[model samples]
Target chain A: MNALLEAQGLHLRFGAVRALDDVALSIWPGEVVAIVGESGSGKSSLLRVLAGMQRADAGQVLYRDAAGATHSILDASDAALRRLMRSDWGFVHQNARDALRMEVSAGGNVGERLMAAGNRHYGNIREVAAHWLERVEMDPARIDETPKNFSGGMQQRLQIARTLVTSPRLVFMDEPTGGLDVSVQAKLLDLIRGLVADLGLAVLLVTHDIAAARLLAHRIMVMRHGQVVEEGLTDRVLDDPRHPYTQLLVSSVLAA
Target chain B: MIVLHTEALAKSFTLHLQGGVSIPVLRDVELTLRAGECVALAGPSGAGKSTLMRCLYGNYGADSGRILLRHEGAMIDIAAADARVMRAVRRDTLGYVSQFLRVIPRVPTLDIVAEPMRARGVAPDEARARAAALLTRLNMPPALHGLPPATFSGGEQQRVNLARGFAAGHPVLLLDEPTASLDAANAEVVIALIAEAKAAGCAIIGIFHDTAVRQRVADRLFQILPVYEPA
Candidate 1:
């Protein structure tokens, strides 16, 4: 109850192809909900819709704010939506390049969110950027370096630092650890997991990795054909899947 | 009255690469939520739970359904609203704390935490004061407040993340694994925050992998059934 976001009768299409159809879901404050499916299962498409990164042909998306007010995200203006992204919400791209300004220095990346909000003290901005670097396990000395010079993992870390610096209440992520090596992914996962909990964040993570879902999400939603086939608590879904598709999915992961 | 509810929600996907193979991702999902409730969503790997969440957040468009909410004495259906209406809803009604924290590079942890307040027209000094207080409550060391939180440890950065989430004091919160890589102590701190939020009448939805934590916080469970039965 006391809901934060709600979607009903969502419909979308690309040419003759339907990307989303009659999808519904809700998020309360302080919740982590994961969307899991195969690569073609429309997981990314769904995340994009919820984050307002894409437009739907039909249906509605409603959002409730901290002030106990509700608005329709589907009906929001570009400027209003942009403001939401800048203040009340945050989005984490699967690829750091999609989210970060690759040319910006690590410090500038973090400080710019503050600058956008009107903080003018250059010294303070750099100081804070260096601090965030330390928090994400990057070398503070690299704060002046551009993401182009950093390793994939470090670039991802910098991206996270940039997005999280403003502390938006809602965050949308798409395969946050997808492109990294296993070792790098593991480290990033650890960082993500820790930060998520500490913040009591509400997340919608899209991934095909069962382990990632198991380690990070509180509730898991399995998708097939752009529709939800199964969903429930993470443990119960993974351990005692009910739907036959769910059973197969779980077993396959276990077998893997 | 339910704080949030959905009826007859459905969604599908069409793959272009395979000559537009149509895939049904969600079909006829019905859900209801109340304040101070933490409901856990469960299902198979590809069941569209994430899609459903996105739909709820207005990220994904729905085919047909009603996402109804009781807010400030009016009922609104999010599924069919316009862009302007949706933006207002986002600003005052919903708060989503995502899996990863993304900031503008080089912003101090304090300013990042304070940015929300500043947007609301709170004075810079006042917003920073509140941010500092929240950081302290979350156990962030004072020294880190002035820093960027970029290079800190995972636990430390997450604390800053938490500080920012709480800074807004939103009524409804969305979480994705609020305690993933954290050591026991940090996880406990998050758990306490969740408890506090729930007690304060904030409704919460979350994706949690930690069974103990899920059991500790969730008020009930919701399940989504896969669309097509396996052969």
Candidate 2:
């Protein structure tokens, strides 16, 4: 099977700090690959590089379209990348406030994606937005309420709903459940798991939470000092991590 | 037909806190199971029975071997299967019932049992109905169906775990001391469940310490010999 996105020899540096170094990964359709590390481990940098939000100092990132055409993400024009983002890719930021229009109504936040994707019928857009609100476990009655009025968890859910309303083939999620209360985090994780499975969406997730990566990712990459120290099946990597750094990272997590 | 087997499977644990001493558990263990057969793992304590089970279930990675199983009409090595493949295998081909229930707080007993079925795409109502039937067969009353199993007795919780394990009807099932907490009557219920599963051509590997239960449910015994090192 052709990979939906592939990156090789990814290298990025800020001053003397190597944010990404020789990182390579391939995400297949419907697969969830998580990049995990402590803060400043280049996990987020890898995500940004792959998603075209940030450029790598060196490397090739190839995106295979549904028609089997390969496009170089690094060399793609800004307009081309924007079209892909609006049509085939979705990015969920760590902070909902970063992704959402806080002042816009919840329904509009979701509807805006469909509009960007060329949906013009007002009633159809509203109906689709309402369905997505319910899909994310939010009440459709809150369609008119601004996301600023919702709790952090609810705002995150709205962000997810907006990102997924267009049913993009591949999604970039950077700690989607980060900054939420533990209980709310679990609920959001459950919702994300369900939607990802139901839609068969391919995902590249960056998280420092080992437990969340285990729960959602099919595969895992462990990073340290901007280098991938280990990569393997999520359970195998967590249960019997071969790399010393990965072992320490796994052992440090407090057992639930 | 052979459903699962292991080849030269080995595992060891490193005591990093204790001067990095390594203790080997299983070494070159070979085992096989066929459909409609129940092979009970037999051995004394510390014979690496649990370790072998964990390796087979992918809870512990194999040090140097393969856990080959027939999944989706193909032989796949569980030792090397990525999480996506393992998840699909667990959903449609393999099932495990641990000794204790990993209780999900606030989830009702019926939902707990029905969850595996739901993951396999079974309708919610149908899955719940099957869960209720299995729970009832194990002597769980309808009155307790809506309540969480967290506060239930050990035997009741084990029954819930067993119901969930058997609910998905996976072709291969692993039971780790499945009836440890159950009473005589509940043990009888488990024995009957095993018989029914075997009759339906389900392949089972289990650890039953109770000789009577083992004799009744297991078609054969696979001994796990401990690897003793020179001290």
Candidate 3:
């Protein structure tokens, strides 16, 4: 099967820094590709390029949503890109504060996505947002409250609910479990893994934790200094060390 | 080791916009959070997550019940604490990150982050240096530090908020849903930094919706209930 979202020979730079250089990868339908890297390794730059926030200095990101429509993310106009983001693609940020409009309540945050997709009925929006909130382990009462009142974990969940409420086809998540504690992280990862599997949505997850990649990704790609050092099935890469960086990452969690 | 406590913590809003009408945003709620542990409050739209946080932070007073803060050598009855006490606690012991850009309009980014230090009477030169270090940790560009934060991107603005919240050396940090706008990669960077801060012994309280974010950082979790109908 052809890859749903594919990148070829991608390169991005900011004066002295080569954020992404000659990077290539692909994701088939319902695939989870974990991009792992250390700090300053261009993990985010790659996601940004794929999301069409920053125009790539070189290369292309080819993506196809569930409806079998394909487009180049980097080539679309602002309106076209916005429409796609609103309807087909959902981006989950690491921080709940940035992903939501703080000025509005939690219901508004989730409802805005629905409105963007043309759901104007307040009653319907509330019902859908409530259901998603519960799935993400949130109470419906806090929907009127801004994320300010809740804990860090809840904010991230709200962000997920806001996007997933629309049932997006592809989600780009950057370190979904970065700041959360172990128990909460466990429950959340379980939720995400289950949700993705059930919905069959393709996901691109970015994280630095090898364990996270092992647990959530179908395949893992290790990035160092703005380029992919190694890429393969998660279990295979974990079982046999191919790249030096991969070696360092996997050995840390070894049973022996 | 409890840093903040809410007993029967209840709040309500009376938005009399249309001919003596009232809106009860929150209702009977109770919460207690200890130091060194992160907690997540999960709820749907109108569930009162933000309302609870604001009431705790003293953004708005709860209509009834009591909010208590217990710190080393200082215990506060948050409900009755005067503005002076609140200011002192907020300055020396509290760090807050709201969902939106909370920085002063047109203020240089450096000053915004370093505002806490300046508030605590730190020297101007030293505060600037502290701001620089925090900004660097958050991956903010050095050159952008001198400009007013209003011109910065949403990510940078939030970074500035985080910097300001932490720069004060406050023991308890409060964040209102900090990562709803960033792409995945930048989101990771911010969340990782929050973890580092917590490990450094800052009592961090954050509001978030991303399950992964909550699961990764929270030590305890609560579901803040809301009153669907206002009386």
Of the true interface contacts, what fraction does each candidate have? 0.00, 0.44, 0.00
Least accurate 10 contiguous residues by lDDT in model 2 chain A: A235-244
Once fitted onto the true fold, the runs of candidate 3 whose alpha carbons sit more than 4 angstroms away are A254-256, B1-231
**lDDT (Cα, 0-100) at A94 in candidate 1:** 80
TM-score of the B chain in model 3? 0.92
Which model scores highest in TM-score? 2
Lowest summed lDDT window (length 10), candidate 3 chain B: B13-22
Q: Which stretches of candidate 1 lie over 4 Å from their true place?
A: A254-256, B1-231
- lDDT for predicted candidate 3 compared with the true structure: 0.78
Looking only at chain A, give the TM-score of model 1 against the true structure.
0.95
TM-score of each: 0.54, 0.90, 0.52
Better of 1 and 2 by TM-score: 2
**Would candidate 2 be rated incorrect, acceptable, medium or high by CAPRI criteria?**
acceptable
Q: Order of all candidates by DockQ, from best down to worst?
A: 2, 1, 3
- lDDT per residue for candidate 2 within B1-231, as digits (tens), equals 999989999899875545677889999999999999999999999998988888888877788889999998988999888766787888899899999887755679999899889888899999999999999999999999999898999889999999999999999999999999998898988999999999999999999999989999999999998898878
- Candidate 3 lDDT over A57-106, as tens digits, reads 98988888666778898898999888888988889988878788888888
Where does model 3 sit among the CAPRI classes?
A: incorrect
